[model samples]
Target: MTQPRVAKDWYESAGVRSGPRRMLEEDREFGLEVFPERLVPHLAHEGLADLGAEGRRALLTQHFYQYMLFTSHLETKVVNRGAALVAHGEVDIEVGPEARLDAFKIYSDEAYHALFSLDVVQQVEKVTATPVLPYDFGPRMARLDRTVERFLPDHGALGHLLQVVAFETVVTRFLAQIPRDEKVFRVVREVVGDHVRDEVHHHAYFSRFFKELWAGLPPRTRSEVACSMPHFVNDCLRPDLGPVRAALLSVGVPADRAEEVIRDCYREEMLVAGVRDAGRHTLALCETVGAFDFPEAREQLQLLGLAD
Candidate 1:
């Protein structure tokens, strides 16, 4: 592996280094939508779209709650753990002290993200009076587990690290749109805005880390792992339709209609485009590291329609 280098001016420029981010200030005027309708695709379904303003508002609020739910889980369960492993040298890579220190920063940032996500969840629950419906990480984790078993059965910590790399590097539209969208509530905008700022540095750190890690892997192992990249990219970008369906049902849409709405709104083409667009940076990073140097690796990604 190439010698790992510390990110440039991380302590001075990182959002976490400035001091703990201020907690989101609740807006007294809570009537503004907590999430933009454009961010939630299923809301565009004809039946769900016709639910009128108040109904749409409730669904948007619930979608925001689910967004926090995803953030909290991703920060605590996925990113933090991966960052902790790197910081402590528990992972397979041999990173420099500077790299480990940056991983510690990532770890700290993600934990703070989880706390604020839950805090917003509480504030929104009180303000909107929309009870958070049942949500679970089981199915998501299970799908990931199944994918790993199929593609990299003995991956162990490598699997975890790869998942972290995928999520950190893949910028999703939902995260990008929330802060600048004036239609979203002020508090929600502030919360996501804080997150987006931190992620900018985190993205750079992980991109460099992935290149270093790929340089360190054996050629055969590299080929095997590269085959799984498209799957991981899809996992990172695909919308969690389970929660969307539940939110729809809770908001009084019939179960049948909810399923139809999700299916219609998230067609195969739309999903492929979302995954490709969101994962473009990750794919380019892999290409930089020669992850697709082997014909088989390129073929695997092409089969997923992620590359030409």
Candidate 2:
């Protein structure tokens, strides 16, 4: 049995009481230039390509926009929605008052996270003056929704809940790295770090909740969710070269150089490093939830190099 976490402390630890409250001003310790290195393939970092400071900066800033956008999307759509279902018993999963209370707290946290992520984006825009990827705002979640519907037409919420559980269970590791990564800007570090603190607690919450949800679910529904979960995880972690390519072009990176960057950056080895590792937590959690117990799902995850 998975240990149940005290949900109330998570509410307190969301940093609403105290943490980076003011807008991030441009500062010397954390300049825009140094924010997280190696936006492209390791070749660029290894001096195989001359992307220049501006090119690298543009790449990182574009990546920052993606980071914030996804964060907001997750907090609002996935986490918040999951909590709402649990709190209101809209889904089949039954909830006690204590669990519902905790879910409400998470509901608040998710909303705040969504709001704060956009604020960080604005602060980043002030410093970098780069285009945040608003165009990407809809496609990712939409893709997941479409895929889930195709898989479980009658029970879309089951897939959504599974995906949310998968992502939240594993997202802590991804969020935790940002705060400690000295290469990123200080404010950005603080922003992600603060989020990480909450996610640590969230990881616990989702892990326990998913176990309960899975136990309550019917066998056929569980089987269906197991099959569909990997695709949702893929949707979350796979890096699209489209935005990267556009950002490079916007910054006057020659087309040939941009192609080279994309080619080298998205190589099979790099995909394992960036995409697989980014979603490792999700994969593991999915396995625990029996998502990978199905033969087809296991095969799919293995094909994507996500099978452990």
Candidate 3:
């Protein structure tokens, strides 16, 4: 027997012209140029203010090396999965044409994000002496592996949808908060812009999927998952500021000062705004799916310092 043909549409399955594509074009046209002239001095000044001069330089070096590795690893995984999905077009098998188009747009965005991350890695290596280590999120990856084993197998399609929705929501939240003034921030923002654009579609696609899943779940199971969501969100929001901090401390900044700097960076109003937007988006998703009340999610938001 032959496999069934999947439906394609001009806007959905035809190509990658969408929000992400527009953002990429905007970046190419208007994006700030990052280089040693602006970047090195910015790092030096910021580091000096936060950690003493030495600590500042050290943290910059650490960040240069560590972020390259970390983002590279993350982008690689995202690209592989996104490429596979796009190539196979299997995810849209059950969904409507609109959803498939949205998913395709997301896949294209992921590809761009992955390529942008790789480009940043190369750029950092060219300008800095920091050595790239053969390491990344060792403990976290192990934990995710175990969690996937425990949760992914039993949740069926619904479980998978929930996980994807939650993760994409959180990632979009983070990408939207990145600072834009610093050279590093600019580079990071460009890469993340792609992710943010793509994630909007992913969130939409999963919202529909979550609704279907939620309607079918037994009340007891629904309650169990709802209760667990706060902890899950907390774990996801735990910022890995270690690399940033280590970089500062390496340059001779006192540990206390480094901590203060990290806190200040995260405490910016823009970061808070991003958190609020993300929380609202997640709450909206919850409303759509009829999973749990906003009050329950608000508690989680408070735990993450995203709400009062």
Candidate 3, RMSD to the unseen true structure: 7.3
Per-residue lDDT of candidate 2, residues 5-83 (tens digit): 5455554456764555746766644544435664434325343246776666777777778667777877887778767
Note the residue pairs that clash in candidate 3: 12-101, 54-251, 55-251, 59-247, 59-248
What TM-score does candidate 2 reach?
A: 0.85
Question: What local lDDT does model 2 show for residue 226?
Answer: 71
Question: Candidate 1 lDDT, tens digit per residue, 83-186?
Answer: 88899888777867877887887888888888888888887788677888866877777766666777778776787788888999997866788788777777
Query: Which digits, one per residue and each the tens of the lDDT, describe model 3 over residues 86-146?
Result: 3444432345454545555555555655556666655555544444444556654444344
User: Candidates' TM-scores?
Assistant: 0.91, 0.85, 0.59
lDDT (0 to 1) per candidate: 0.79, 0.70, 0.48
Which rank order by TM-score, best down to worst?
Answer: 1, 2, 3
Residue pairs clashing in model 2 are none
> How many steric overlaps are in each model, in order?
0, 0, 5
> What's the distance in Å from true for residue 213, model 1?
1.0
Worst 10 residues of 1 by lDDT: 1-10
